[model samples]
Target: MSAFDGVKVAVLLFVAAIAQVSIFGQLHVFGAVPDILLVTLVAISLLRGSVAGAVGGFFAGLIVDTASLGTLGLTSLVLTLSGFWIGRYGETTGRDRAHAPYLSIAVVTVLYELGLLVVHFVLGESAPAGAVVRSLLPAVVLNLIVTGPVYGLVRRLLRAMERQELSAEVQLLG
Candidate 1:
């Protein structure tokens, strides 16, 4: 990706992180809050590729951790994995599928929540299985509901950026 693209991705993730913490964090629907950052990260990772996704995930997670004053590296690790694997899925089977974004978000939401449970358990924190189980499906549905619009927006932005990059390259060559 070009430097400008990277900047755009970074800014996008930054805004997503802020919204995840400040807005969506409190918006609970059936006791399941939508993870805007995760959905956004997955969208970007799908468009950009694995390395970019991993980097974006890490950066966004770090910002979230710092902003929320949570345990350092907790979200970073989870989102890094989320982004990387989602990117791989995009690069492989799902890239061209019309349902890829919704599928990715649903699957990742389940896995991400499970991963958080494992991390919390390993860290000697109470990994409330009941809570996780109860919220998991609802969260997946909520994420899927938003995935369409969020992914569409990100895809449009990336396509526009890609077109600009290609036009610039053509100009330089001409």
Candidate 2:
């Protein structure tokens, strides 16, 4: 990965984390919250690939774990696996803007909840079906709803970064 890409990813992680914790929590529907980090990971996976997805998920999850009542590394592990699978799928399947990200995010929100369930179970925590249904369902819906616009932003940022890279390359070759 280019150093620029790394920097971009870092900035994304930072913003995503802050947005998740600060802004997203402020807006509530059905007593639910939007998971910007989750959406970000899915978008990154669809737009880039599994490796980038994994890194994004890892950082996002780690931040969540530290920021909330949940156990440490739970989100990290879940998000990392989610990102890996998402990225791997992206690599095998051609990305189409019309529906790929929406489809991926739709499915992934469920997978993310599933991963959380498994982690909670492994940790000997009680499995509350209502947690996902009552709380996370709305969160998932909100994430899917926001995915399109957020994905566009990520795309725009990537294109800008790509232009910078291209300019740098041309200057080097001059």
Candidate 3:
């Protein structure tokens, strides 16, 4: 990707990170909050590629970690994995599929939460199994709800920007 594309990804992730921490993180519904950052990362990764997705995930996780003042690399690790695999999925199978975004969001939501629990357990933190189980369904549903609009917007933004760049390149070459 172009440097401009990287910058755009960064800005987009930055906005999503801020919104996730400041807004979505606080807006708990049915014992779960919508993970705007995760959904955004998934959308971008799907549009871009695995490398971009992994990089975006790492930085976005860092932003969340620093913003929330929680464990530093925790979110990064999860997001990195989510971003990489999701991007690979996009690259391989899901990119053209109509239900890719929804399926990706749902599957990743579950894996992300489970990964969180595992990490917490490994870290000797109070990993509440009951709470995780109880909130799993709601979180999945909330994430699915978020995945649609966010994915559409991200897809539109990337395509428009890329199209503009392509046309500019063509003009210059002509």
For TM-score, the strongest prediction is 1
Q: Please provide, for model 3 over 29-144, each residue's C-alpha lDDT reduced to its tens digit, 9 standing for 90 to 100.
A: 98889999999999998989899999999999999999999999999999999999999999999988989999999999999999999999999999998898899999999998
| lDDT per residue (tens digit) for residues 44-68 in model 2 | 7776788888888888888877877
C-alpha displacement of 160 in model 2, angstroms? 3.2
Q: Which ten-residue region of model 3 has the weakest summed lDDT?
A: 156-165
Q: RMSD, each candidate, Å?
A: 1.9, 3.0, 2.1
Order of candidates by lDDT, top first?
3, 1, 2
lDDT accuracy of residue 68 in candidate 3: 98
Q: What is the TM-score of each candidate against the true structure?
A: 0.94, 0.84, 0.93
Query: What do the candidate models score in CA lDDT, each in turn?
Result: 0.93, 0.80, 0.94
lDDT, candidate 2, at 123: 86
Which candidate would rank higher by TM-score, 1 or 3? 1
Give candidate 1's root-mean-square deviation (CA, Å).
1.9
In candidate 3, stretches whose alpha carbon ends up further than 4 angstroms from where it belongs are 164-174
Candidate 2 has its poorest 10 consecutive residues by lDDT at 94-103
